[model samples]
Target chain A: MSNTPLLSTRGLTCRFGGLTAVDRVDFDVRPGQVHAILGPNGAGKSTLINLLSGELRPSEGEIHYRQHPIHGLPAHRVARLGIGRSHQKTNIFPRLSCLENCRLAARIHLGGVIASWRSRAAARQVDERAEQALATCLLTHRASTPASAMSYGEQRQLQIAMVLATAPTLMLLDEPLAGMGREETSRVTGLLRALRDDYTLVLIEHDMDSVFALAEQITVMVDGRVLETGTTAAIRGSEKVRDVYLGRHQQEQA
Target chain B: MLHRYPKRVPIIMLALTVLLVFYPLWGPVLIGDGSDFFLEKLTLMLILGLFAMSLDLLVGVVGLVSLGHALFFGLAGYTLALASPSYSAASLWWMMPLVMLVSALAALVIGALVLRTRGIFFIMTTLAFGQMLYYLVSDASFTGGSDGVFIMFKPTLAIGELTLIDLESPLQFFYFVMGMTLLTYLFLHWLIRSYFGQVLDGIHDNEHRMQALGYATYGYKLAAFVISGVLAGVAGMLAAMQYGFANPAQLGWHLSGEVLMMVILGGMGTLFGPLLGAFAYELLHYAFEHLTLYWQLLMGLTIILIVLVLPKGLAGLILDPPRLRLPRVGVGGLLRPRPAASTKARLGLAGHHKHEEG
Candidate 1:
């Protein structure tokens, strides 16, 4: 919070007619920090991430990144300014090979359309970045396999690799652990831990154990409202958080 | 470096090219002696192939099914007809460049408006634009209205006193179309292989994801549209010069649908598929008409049968034949149905193998 925040929002709000999906939420993520947004169903975590990522513009309030206002910019422009987002579902080019998927992501950051007219291999840097990201996600062996041919877990990992290939300074990941076996969950959890060293991360997940283990700062939400933003230990110990979001999930787990 | 080398691709392309380049000369012997009709249809097939290739650029590669593609192609033909000796006596030099420029600019304008919408809306907008052009041309007196326009004298290519390839003779013109088609193919082939091509493919696969990855999806789609439109225009220009006429039929919705059918029938994503699709469709149309007046009904049935049987287009069958493996017989004897338990055990092993693949 002391060092210039990578991304910050003030009173950001989104409404769906009668329902306010995101209700004037306020939070800031510092550089290289793992920030988790925890909430029960309908707490509007995805909506908040969408609003911040410029997929949906805020009806009210401001979002600043690198000390510049960016609430109204288009999603692509927001990404170019270094905020890459992974969807809640594993979203990737299904027909394209896993390496090609990551390569496409890297190519957008590397010169885009102008560089597109040359053979993809000619851009050595793009390949290296794609390979590096693939390796990080443990998808190197499946690099030549079509994304459609991949398992649910592999596709999920490939989605993260895609985000990483873009070389974003910050990544907004929505449910990175959503539909995974125990081993897959542990693999992704480890991948997230390593990723936090270089890029600021804002993760939205329902997994309490990974959230507690990885998050430096945790923001607990209830019914589209940010109830508290505190350290992992503080949020875990807070009576209010325990009674609201974690209590419900912990009981379900038990 | 990332693309794997295919050993047979170059050889196949070379054989197809050589056969096409010499078709007019030697084709008569194979079909029947002195059949100008065969040459004419084959030439038309090549031009339609080019048109379909351009559309496939949008439909297959970019996932935009543009219904306005004929507008660019027909407009180029219209411009050439008016510029030629029948109207203003404009030379081919100035006439061709001016018309191509006009068509490209028109594509840019239409692409800007159309690329804004998506899905059925985008398809509808393109259809509207194509119909608008068709109506404007058919209703206008300068365009000869419903009567259409003709090119009396084929434009000659010359630099000062030195003459290059003349556009008058059918043989020369066929060669011109061939050369243009080849150039278009080579250029597009290079483009699809490029990084830009990959991005366009990505956009088709998942536009939202590409945008999230920092791609200006709209801009790339528009550029692709214009490129496709320009290529279609070039094909239209060739068609006009070949037939010595430009009519409302060139710009009509039927033409748009015909080319779309060609792209789908050939294969959507691959470059050569459109060419093969155009040839097959044209040949079938010719053959059916010769057989009976109910050619339309027959053609429709054939297309349905093809879809049912092939599933993939004509090119897809040749290029990537679907695997059809039969069950292996046991060493002890020929295969036969086993008892319940053994049947289940055998099926389980096969199921396990399929599961690993899946």
Candidate 2:
């Protein structure tokens, strides 16, 4: 497709000392699609998200987000450019109340940083957006609870709520569903599925069934390099993908 | 944790307000000493309290341990000292804002450089800058070098020909210091509760998360640092006006340690705690000085005893209605990370890489 991708990377590479963490790779993340990056634990999926979110600098590459070169920008700068990401470990303001955490995130998108002078009426938008995010994550009931008080699964949900509150055009969720019971996994999967309508989502997740179920497109990375980028059917049906990423268990199932 | 002002808080505030207003009359009576020295000590308490409160903005709100905070305080005092006191035209109109602006600018520059570092590095860099200012004043001829500079007369307030407040009188001067303290407290109270304050609090909890959520954390921190310095400068200005002197020692690392101790002893984050800590420290010093020349030793013992007993500092025992959470070791937990900070990268940005190494 010659159409402009929401976020595109060309020869993106990151090195820690002499070791290359993320090797030169390229992909075009189309607008309004759930592009899932599937990999083993050390496949550098998290590193890719880190580079995208500006947590780590790319050793070599160009990352264009909405036609702007954002590879070298700091995390906050990237965030200001309407790109938000979540951590695999459920990053959140643990001391702050759930609503407060969301409010802090929402205010950045809804208003200026120096908003001390603005009246409550003027900042009503921030509160509304925060509440909406909470509702979307089904965390409205626990809004007043400190984030630390929430169950781990609930905190994971709060993580999504936080990124959602930022109101980004594109979201890079790092392992949005890592540790979850059956119900929470489905709930988050449902949430991710719903988010596809509003946000261009790049999710790094290990849950194959969930990825296949939710993602329209998938990128399989092996040892910091992309094995293949294709539709779920293509990835599932590929012999190499089955042998390497899926293991022999997936081949027997096929 | 549950949080609320105690029922006695309003009563305490009202009582304190009433007592301060009637201080000239009742202050002499209640102290029993009823001496000029007693009143002066009380006034010093109020000014130092303001200084401690300013440091709290950095330590408590932003979770930034600034060791060079005394730079702004001493710089403002020195500005008043170095300037020609010959001009009677310098009123509250120009002087206060001017000192505040200079101090804020210094904080801005210092903050820009120091804020890039975190934890121990941030502390050491601030300490380094604090010493630089101390030495600059101590060695500079314009600053009176180590001998220090002196203000010829206290700053007076007037509008054109109108003589509004005559600061020469000790009682009036005392009230003026108290007025500034109250004003600073009010401004800070408003600030820490504002959207900016909440954002700073979020940044303190998890900077990376705040950044990920789209906040320019560095800007917020720099702004907070400037606000903190400006308030501190205001305190220094008041102190300079009162003492009619600006010593290089005021800029020294010693003062930084003292003020940090005050914030920690009073309770790091609470608005009123620093003031209480200042009062506690000053009073103990005063009481001990009266008894013996080796007052510092006794002062140290008392502070240690007090800190050990009230781990959350004076504010925990006296001001904060709710216990909230247990106090971590380290003054206001400056050395120890906040409870939430341990899990800060819970979404696992830094942690994910550890596995990458394996």
Candidate 3:
């Protein structure tokens, strides 16, 4: 992997009214690495992801992706610049089929005014990309099924499939396993591991086991600030991260 | 619902097309010489149907409920009247395109401003823009100050020395309108199944997700608004040709509301529904008028009944018959609250794990 970070934030901050959801934080994700962001609820983990994805404008900071400043750019522009994100809350077009959901994301790379008179099915490349994404996420069997009809785990897979279909080099995923059962969680973990070879991932997850297994780098946050940033083994050995976030999580599990 | 009975829908549509195409021939036999009057009415209905269909592109497909749709419709009529010489007819070739261009420009400007807002604010802003235009035409002296302007002659379509369509005759005008309506329906059918329409569907379903997928959704919406405006302009120009007058009322909010009602009455998302609605609404208006002086009251009651009974509108009857079961009328039934099960079922969560997070 290159030493130059694919995406890096310098002094990033987001304040909602009087509450600073994300304090001034410097963070980075090297190319082709699974970088996991772990924190308790309201640790500004999702907020940081939102900032990187351009869903929310930072109050203070510069976000550089591939050395291009992208802080103030809108989400669509950020996405066009090869960044994609999945929502914490399952955000997919529920009424549309799984294939259609992926097709909509894949077609963005076609990059022109959509021909209003042509059939959507005629775009063979978009369909192929969509099918490939579904296949990657093991959702190819559910291609014709409406998203709402799928199980919650399948829906989460569809969400990742949609981002995958966009063909972004860097992906910001918020809690991809937030509500999945054990089997579903393991399946998604496997999917993420497979994805690690192809794309740089910034994951915000509460599932510590999967976080340790899938991520090469880990960042722990507490109360809108980064507590630690290190390799998985380094973070596992950190005292401050244990006391602030992981200790409480383990206690709850116990 | 429409897709469920796909085989039947085409057959029904084919039958309807056959009926409409042969109406000119068969209509006179049934109505005698008064068929001309009915034909004129039908032509007007077709024009309004086109208008409603254009609005549906925004309201139904793009999920933009624009209350200012009449602005384009009325503006096109005024354009035709203004461009035509007081003593001579204008060429259909140029005037039609000019009016459409004007309407498109207006939509582009207004959509750019109003699309920045969401939901109720968007609706109000559109309504406000439409009202502003209405007053501009109503109070302005050059626009005849609510007295309206009249077109002296219908537009002529000619290729050099040969006249292709003399839009003056009632029979010819009816056929022209029918042809236009068919073309619009076919075009819209193809459009809604296209890549552009799929993006629109995604926007309608979840705009934020579409944005995350890297679509500049604003551009798509603006394009839809402009395209819809241009189509509404065509309908407006046709109306002016038929009536030979452009009035302030055409630009009024009531007309906009009426077109909205037509869209709802037919079915919001179905391209064919708006046309069905326009015909049904106008036919009801005509029938009710002859039945009593208090026709509006009867119309109001009928509409309320239809809405309560057929929540999906008239198209629902053909699309999904099973769901159109009438509510049982009983004192206990009326008093009892609806079961939550049905709501869950409607959401497609009937057999799934209810507590699972979406």
Model 2 lDDT tens row, B1-358: 1123566755765687677778778766766776567777778889999999999999988889988888888999987766635544356777887898899889989999999999999999999999988888888898888989878877778788787778877888888888888888888877787778877877766788788887788898999998999989998888888888899888888899999999999888887888888988897887899899999999899889988988878777764344446676767664555455336435333433332332
Chain B TM-score for all candidates, comma-separated: 0.87, 0.86, 0.90
Q: List where candidate 2 sits over 4 angstroms from the true fold.
A: A1-3, A119-122, A248-254, B1-4, B32-34, B87-90, B160-162, B319-358
Candidate order (TM-score) = 3, 1, 2
lDDT, candidate 3, at B14: 83
Any runs in candidate 3 off by more than 4 Å, and if so which?
Answer: A112-122, B1-5, B323-358
Q: Would you list the clashing residue pairs of candidate 1?
A: A116-B195, A116-B196
**lDDT agreement with native, every candidate:** 0.85, 0.83, 0.87
Which of 1 and 2 is the better model by lDDT?
1
Write the residue-wise lDDT of candidate 1 on B185-301 in tens digits: 888888887777878877876687778899889888888988898899888988988888899999999999989988889878787878889988998999999999999999999
Binned by DockQ into CAPRI classes (incorrect, acceptable, medium, high), candidate 3 is medium
Over the stretch A105-158, how does candidate 1's per-residue lDDT look in tens digits? 888788875664465554888889999999999899999986766777888899
Q: In candidate 2, what are the lDDT values of residues A1-254, reduced to their tens digit?
A: 33679999999999899878789989889998889998777888899999999999999999998888998899988998889899887677666689988888888876665552465664787789889999999999999987766777888999899889888989999888888999999999999888988889999987778989999899999888999999989998998988887884465558
Give lDDT tens digits, candidate 3, residues B1-358: 1223356677887898788779887999999988889989989999999999999899989999989899999999999999998998899999988998999999999989999999999999999999999999999988888899999998898898788877999888888888888888888887777678888877886787788889999999999999999999999999999999999989889899999989989888887788889989999999999999999999989988988888878777667555434556876764565576466446654322331333
Write the residue-wise lDDT of candidate 3 on A1-254 in tens digits: 68999989999999999999999899989998999999888889988988888889999989999898999999899999989999988888766789988988888876433531254554777888889999999998999997877888998999999999999999999999988999999999999999999999999888888999999999988889989999999999999989888899999999
**Stretches of model 1 off by over 4 angstroms after superposition:** A1-4, A115-122, A138-151, B1-13, B24-26, B87-92, B322-358
TM-score of 2: 0.89
